[model samples]
Target: MTEPERLRADAVRNRAAILRATEELLAHHHPQQISMEQVAAAAGVGKGTVFHRFGSRHGLMRALMQERAQDLQTAITGGPPPLGEGAPPRARLLAFLGAMVELVARNKGLLAALGPAPVATAPEQEPREEHPVYRAWHGHLSRLIHQQRPDLDDDMLAHVLLATVHSEPILNALEHGAADRLERTLRDLVSGLMPEG
Candidate 1:
């Protein structure tokens, strides 16, 4: 029995309302196009309430992304063969990359809302690695690639692979009717890297 096990009523209601409003707004607009003020108004709560609940727009986006991201993470860590445990390195790697493509596509609007940090031109520029989603994907892919080829720099390779799914490229693919080609493209890339059995 803990705090969440006890479950406060108002907190539950507020959380539900906020999430519902977020989903509604996100359906038609990118995350960056919306704001805390808009979310508060849509949620029927004060701005303070929004801040209290989610800290910032980034936090709100992260909370929304977490459920979907967690699903992919669970599959990679424990779900089943090919995507999870007990699969050959190449199979699992392909599955992981494919899953990433799906996740990015599904959350296209959210990623647009949480774009890559602006290029650093000054001391006041924000941290470059602020997106938790990218960090998670990179870490997971690094581990998988490292297991396959210790001779390669897995971290850099992971960055390069994940870069393929960045919002700019993905959104372009979607517009040019080439989005369906992404998974196959990744499959070919990974196969070329790892070579066939």
Candidate 2:
């Protein structure tokens, strides 16, 4: 290959190596404890290569989060049953929440190892009405509820149902040995949210 082409290939390899090392390290050690030298060594590349790939530690962390978010979006949109499609709206809603709780549990471990970094709260970026996941979940649930019971306020009901199933609090309870109680409470919550006889 030409010299420039070879150099480009090498850079690609180095970037991949650094990202892999960052993910592995982030899984087990806090980000503050991680250093460019450690990532370079782990990636089997020179320290300078790590810097070239990511300008700083925060940049690397952002890259990691972006990658994780992409992976999660893909899984939720393409993976099995409830997550993808092929279940009743009510059942799928429950399943989606359960799966999300499990995912948060796993991610919490990795995030903890990455240390407590402040997350930017973006209230303005809430999913739009047409976003596929939002539409698929809320629209489908609303349809199902309306089909079975036309009297309920579908929009408000769907929001309340989903809001209660958020994963962070669920993960906290699970970590605190309150998983069984949480499960019972979730069931009660779900039942209460549904249209009454």
Candidate 3:
């Protein structure tokens, strides 16, 4: 490959390495305790590399979240079945919620770290609505809800459903082996929203 192409490839590899290292560190240390220096050391790159790639700790966490959610995003955007484009709106909504429960269960540590702390909040923190991932999920839900129930306020309802899946109570339930009950409740909530055919 040409010089520029080689550099680009190297950058991609470096980015992946950094994300993997961060994931490893998050598995052991609290997110607040895992610094860029540690990430660089584990990733076999310079501290500057981590900062350069992600800008800050928050940015790194967001990148990690995006990476973890990439597969779900792809399946939603292109893959077949209820999670994708081929199913009814209610079915898609149910599938999406089910997938999100799995995702949140797997990444609760990272997700909790990424969220605002109740004790010490960042004054200039971005709103949840402004986050790209939240926007994508909300937009998808809004569209599906609108398709299923045109008379309802799709935007608010989407937010409510998304909140239900991402709420701390749900996360705690997942941790406590209450996934079956959680799923049933979510399914019932969504099903109740749809008009009977």
Candidate 4:
């Protein structure tokens, strides 16, 4: 490859290395505690490389979230029965909630590390609806609810359901040793809302 091509290839490799390091750290450490310097060291690159690629710690987290969200979106859109398609509306809704719980749980660790980001007087204060991952999730759940129970207020129900799976609430439950209980409760909540035969 030419010099220019080799340089471009190195950039790609560096970007991948940074993301991989961030992901591994996210699994075991809170986002706030894991600094850009640590990530650079873990990735075996200079700190400049990390800053050049991600810009900031928040940027890095956003990239990690998008990566995770893409995988989840793929599963929900075309992977298989229940989450994707080819199931009854009620069944699909249940499966969707189940899958959502797992997704939230995986990301909840990050929040556990964050510890009450942007604290609000009300429980519903945290709203990240504009993020692509969040927007896609909200749209999918809202659409599913509308399809099954047209009479109900779909927008309101969708917001509330998604709220249940948000990072703060999930992390709180996990902290209290109630993660399983929370999942079961979410299942029950969604199950109750499903339209009857």
Clashes of each: 1, 0, 0, 0
For 94-181, candidate 2 gives per-residue lDDT tens digits of 5655554444444554444333221211245433344344455566556656754578887777666545434456555655766456
Cα miss at 138, model 3 (Å)?
A: 1.1
| Candidate 1 TM-score, true structure as reference | 0.75
Worst 10 residues of 1 by lDDT: 116-125
Worst 10 residues of 4 by lDDT: 114-123
Whole-model lDDT per candidate: 0.75, 0.61, 0.81, 0.73
Candidate maximizing lDDT:
3
For residues 102-130, what per-residue lDDT tens digits would candidate 4 score against the true structure?
66566765544433431111234345666
Q: lDDT of model 4 at residue 171?
A: 62
Candidate 1 off by > 4 Å: 1-13, 32-48, 117-132, 175-177
Off by over 4 Å in 3: 116-125, 195-197
Give the per-residue lDDT of model 1 (tens digit) for 1-197.
57775567667788878978898899888777888999999999899999999898977876777756777888887898899889877788898887777777766677655563211111344443445656777788888888888888999988788777654756667546565699898888888888877
State model 2's lDDT: 0.61
Cα misplacement distance, residue 192 of candidate 1 (Å): 1.0
TM-score winner, 1 or 2:
1
Candidate 3 C-alpha lDDT tens digits along 1-197? 99999999999999999999999998888788988999999999999999999999988887888877777889999999889999999899899988877777767667777763211123476667776677888899999999999999999998887776556667777768776677778888887878457
Q: lDDT order of candidates, best first? A: 3, 1, 4, 2
